[model samples]
Target: MKFAGIGVLNAARKTIARMLGNNEIAYESAKSQFWVVDAKGLITEGRENIDPDALPFARNLKEMDRQGLREGARLVEVLSVKVVIFLLNFDF
Candidate 1:
């Protein structure tokens, strides 16, 4: 999936990470996974600098070729990417 920038990605990533790490224990026995991306393109180990929060989920996941760059790329600007979950909810 795609995000806006370091700040945006960091905020959302840490939030989701907390949600995944906490909510799973809070609600169920299973675990959860999350992915984030932004203007510098896809988040990966190859990228020198990335949001600090994004570090946890930065499993060096594969990147698609067109995952290019833009001066001011927003989440909406992501031309294409793999699926990303934004709002995951549980009854509990």
Candidate 2:
């Protein structure tokens, strides 16, 4: 993914690395891990060290070609149900 400049990519990588290495945060687990995907939906960072059992979204992103990632990327979370329905039905 393309970004405003190399600074963005560097920053993203540093953030992910920090999160992964942070001792106070339970960011990495058997069921959880970090990933950096670009605007075009390609994995930019974290692919090289990804685990095989990562979430389906992470695994899918890893399959894309990061060589062509672009700018305007944003963090996203995938939900099992319609967002509105899920939010309304959720308790607490």
For every model shown, the clashing-pair count is: 0, 5
Q: What is the lDDT of candidate 1?
A: 0.43
Model 1 Cα lDDT, one tens digit per residue, 1-92: 22335355445545765766755462222112334445344445666654554555443333323455343334454434435544222222
- Compose the digit string of candidate 2's lDDT tens values, residues 13-53: 35665767744342333113333333333233344533232
In model 2, what are the clashing residue pairs, if there are any? 1-69, 1-70, 2-69, 2-70, 2-71
Off by over 4 Å in 2: 1-3, 22-92
CA lDDT of each candidate? 0.43, 0.32
Query: Whose TM-score is greatest here?
Result: 1
Candidate 2 local distance difference test against the native: 0.32
Worst 10 residues of 1 by lDDT: 26-35
